[model samples]
Target: MENARRTTLADVARAAGTTVPTVSKVLGGRSDVSAGTRTRVMRVVAELGYRGRAGRAVPPDAGRPPFVDLVLSGIEGTWANRALSGVERAAADAGVEVVVSVTRPPDDAWLTRLLARRLRGAVLALVDTTPDQLATLAAARMPVVLLDPVRQPPGTVPSVGAANWAGGRAAAEHLLALGHRRLGVLAGQRTHLYSQARVDGFRSAVTQAGLDLADDRVVHTDWRRAPSRARAAELLRGADGPTAVFACSDAIALGVYDAAAELGLRIPQDLSVVGFDDLPEAEWATPALTTVHQPIAEMGGAALRMLLRLGTDQPPEAPREELATRLVVRGSTAAAP
Candidate 1:
C-alpha cells in the first residue's frame, strides 16, 4: 500500500491564506493571533488534516518544542555565564529546554530562523528588539521577556532587571561612610538606561552627603576593561585625585585595579575602590572588590519564568520587575587615609 502524503505547516498556511509562521503560531497556542484569524487557521488546519511532524496528526502541542530561546548580544564574561546558568537551572526544573543564541542587532534572518524552529518564547539579554521584529514575533505568537535591557522597552513588554539606582546609591553611601569625601565615578555609556540610572543614583547620594563631584571626577567610558582602565589612570594621575572611586561594573573595576597598580597605589590604602555587579572576578581580585550584588543569576531565572508565563497565555503581574540590589563589602574599600 502506498503511504499517504503528510500535511505540513506550509500547506496549512497556504490553505488558510496566511504565512507559515502565523500557522505555526496558531498551532502552538500563542496568544498574539487575532480571534478571527485563529479561527480561520484552525478551520484550515482541520480541513487539511495537517500532521505537524512524523506524519502524525496534529496534537494539541505538536508544532513546537517546550523550549525557549535565550538570546544575547554576546556571552564573553562571567556576567553572561551566570545568567545562562540560572536560565538553564530554571528551564530544567520546568521540564523545558533552552536554546542559547548570540546575535548582534537581530535581523529578519534571525527572526526567520526562530520561526522556522517554532520556538515557544524568548528571553533577551541586553538585546534590543526593533518595532519590526516585535511585530513579526507578535504575528508568529512568540512571547519575549527582556533581562537587563540596554534600552527601556515598550511599556507593554515585560522586563526583569536589578535596582541599578539603588545599587549606585548604596555604593556611594559605602564610600561616604568610609570618610572618603573626594570621590570619583567611572560611569558607563549614557545611552544605556542602566548606566544612566547608576550615574544618577551616585550623583544623588554624593550631593545629599554635601560633597561635590566635579565634572573632572566623573568620566564616561565604554564599559570595557581597557577604556575604563585608561579613564581611571587619567582620573588618578590628576593633581587632586580622589581617594575613592566607584566603577559602574566589575569589569570596569578591574580597569581601576590596573590603573591603581600602574600608579603604584595600594587598594584601600591609597585608593579605595567599589564596583557594581558582584561577578566572580570581583571576589578573586587581590583585595576582593567591594561591589554591588545585582543578583545576575536571579534576574536570569526571573526573566525565564516571566517568559514561561507569557507563553502560557497568562499576563504578568507587572510589566517591569526590579530585583533588589545590595552592597557586598569586601577588602577593596576602607577609611580615607
Candidate 2:
C-alpha cells in the first residue's frame, strides 16, 4: 500500500493559484489580505485537508504543562480576585497553568516579556491593550482574548464581558421602584466601555421614567475604593443630595457607604444604595449591598476557553460574548423617605 503525502502550505497555495506567502498571510489572520483572497485561500486549505506544520498542533503528551498568560490592569480588589479565580479554575480543568501578569501601562515591554515566555495564548482582563501590542501578538501567532476590556478591541479580537447596559438599567429600575426619584451614580473611569454602557443604560431608564439625571449627579471616578469614596463624599455632601445612589461597581458602592458614614447617613434608613458586580464585599457590607450580579468569574472562565479555542486555530463563534446580569436585592435599599 502506498502512503498518502502530508499536505503542505505550498501545495495548498499552488492548488489555489496563489503564492505560499499569501497562504501564510491568510492562515496568520492578517488583515492585509482581501476578503475574496482570504476566502479563496481558506477554501483551498480546506480542500487540501491542510493542517499547519506539525509544530503547530497541540501536543498530546502530558509531560510538560502548557501555560496561558492572564493579564490584568491590577490585582488588588475583590473584582480582580473573583475574575482571577474563575480563570484559574478553568485553566485547571483544562490542565493548563495560568501566568498572571499586571499591565499597569500595558507597554511594549510587557508584551516583550510575555512573548519571551512562549505562552500558548493570553487572556487580558480589564486591560486596555493598544493596537501595537495586538500587532505584536499577531506577529507571534499568539491568540488573545479580552475580558471586560476598557474599550472595544478590534473586530478580529474575541472578547467576553457582562451585559453592563442591562445591569445598569436594572439598578435604576430597582431604585425607581422604591420611589427614589433623586438619584446619583458613582461611575467608573470614563475610558471603560462597560462603565459607559452602564451609565448610558441607567440614563435611559431614568429618562424613560420621566426623571432627570443631572450632570452633577453622575460622577466618574477611578475604579478603586478610595477614589470612589472621595467622589461619593462630594455627591453626598452636596445640597441637592441624592436620596438613592447607584454605584457602577460594588467597590464604588462601598465608597458610597464610607461617604454616608462621614455625613452621618444610615444605609436604607437615610440613604438607599444599589451597586453592580456582586463581589464578596457586597454581601459583607453592614447592610449588605443590593447589586447587579455580574458573573465576573464566569467571564474569566469564558475568556480562557476562548483563548484555548484560538490556540488550536479555531475561530470564536462570536466576536463578543456577554454573560447575563441579574439584580440581587439585598439589605441596602429601601423606599424613599
Candidate 3:
C-alpha cells in the first residue's frame, strides 16, 4: 500500500509528459533542460513530493547517503590529481561520497550530469561559470564553491585559492637573491586572474631590485609541456638571453629543463630555473627545482569543506579564502653566470 503511494522518478515524468531522465535532470538541478520543460517537471515533482515519496538519490531500502559533486575542466595532471586526492580524503573522513564530473568549454555538461542525482552541493575546480548558470543553480537551491577560480569570480560565488601574488613574488625574490639579473618568464594564460596576479607579484619584486621584464623576455603559453618547451627554446636561444627563468608552474619548469638539455645549457651552471606549485615532480627532477609552494592539495580540501558548510547553510564569515605560499630553495638556481 505504501509502495503504491510512493512518488517515483517515473511518476513525476509521466505527470509532466517527459522522460524519467528529464525529470531526473530537473530534480538534480541541471541547466540543460528547456525552461518550459524544467518548469513542467518541477511542477509535477512538487505536486507529487517526489523526494519525500521515496528518498534523495537511492531508494528507501538503502539509507540515504548524501553526496556532493566535484566538477573540473580536466583532471589530467599532477595539479588536478593532488586536488582530487585532497577532496577524496575529505569526503572519506566525512563519510560522504564524491561524484567527479569533467567538462570543457564551460558548457556545463558536468552540471547537467550532476543535476540528475541528489547532491548536497558542488565544488568547481578550475572551471568557469556564467551568471546564467549560477542563476539556474540558484533556482535549484544548490550551493557552489569554486576551487582556484579562473578569475575573480562574483562576490556571490565563494572560492578557495592560494596566495598567487605572494608566491610569484617569492619566486622572483629567490632568483634575485641568487644574483640572477636578466631573467625570462614562462607565464600561464595572461588573461587568468591568478596568472596576472603572479606576474604582477614577480614584476613587483623585480622592480624593487631595479630591474624589469623585457618585452621579449616574457612568453605566455597555454601551460602545456610541448608548447612551453618550444617557447623556452626560443627564449633561451636568443642573443643575450636571460640566465634564469621563472616558470609559472612546475610543469612549465620541466619544459625549461627540456629546452636547456636541447640547447646544451646546464641548470644552475648556465641556466637557473625556478618554478611554482612545488609539485612532487619538482623534487624528482634531475637537479631538483627551486619553486614556490602553493599548497594545491590543501586548497582542494578547503574548497570541499567550504562546500559542505554551504550545504548545511553555514557559510564562512569570509566568502573568499586564500591560503599562503612559500619558496623552497633547491639545486636549480645559482648565481648569475
Once fitted onto the true fold, the runs of candidate 1 whose alpha carbons sit more than 4 angstroms away are 1-65, 105-109, 311-318
Residues 1-337, model 3: lDDT tens digits? 4556665678778988999888657756667789778767656655664442222333212586778888888878889899998898888888788889988773545656666666778888988676555544543556788899887776667899999999999989988988898988999898888888888899999999999788688889877878899999999996589999999999999999999999999999999999988989999999999999988888988998888777423233438899999999999999989
Q: Model 2 lDDT vs. the true structure?
A: 0.83
Give me the overall lDDT of model 1. 0.81
lDDT at position 235, candidate 2: 92
The prediction achieving the highest lDDT against the true structure is 2
User: What is every candidate's alpha-carbon RMSD to the true fold?
Assistant: 9.8, 8.4, 7.8
lDDT of each: 0.81, 0.83, 0.81
User: Local error of candidate 3 at 178, Å?
Assistant: 0.9
Decreasing TM-score order of the candidates: 3, 2, 1
Name the better of 2 and 3 by lDDT.
2
Candidate 2 lDDT trough over 10 residues, lowest sum: 53-62
* Model 2 spans > 4 angstroms off: 1-62, 311-318
Indicate which candidate wins on TM-score: 3
Residue 169 C-alpha lDDT in model 3:
92
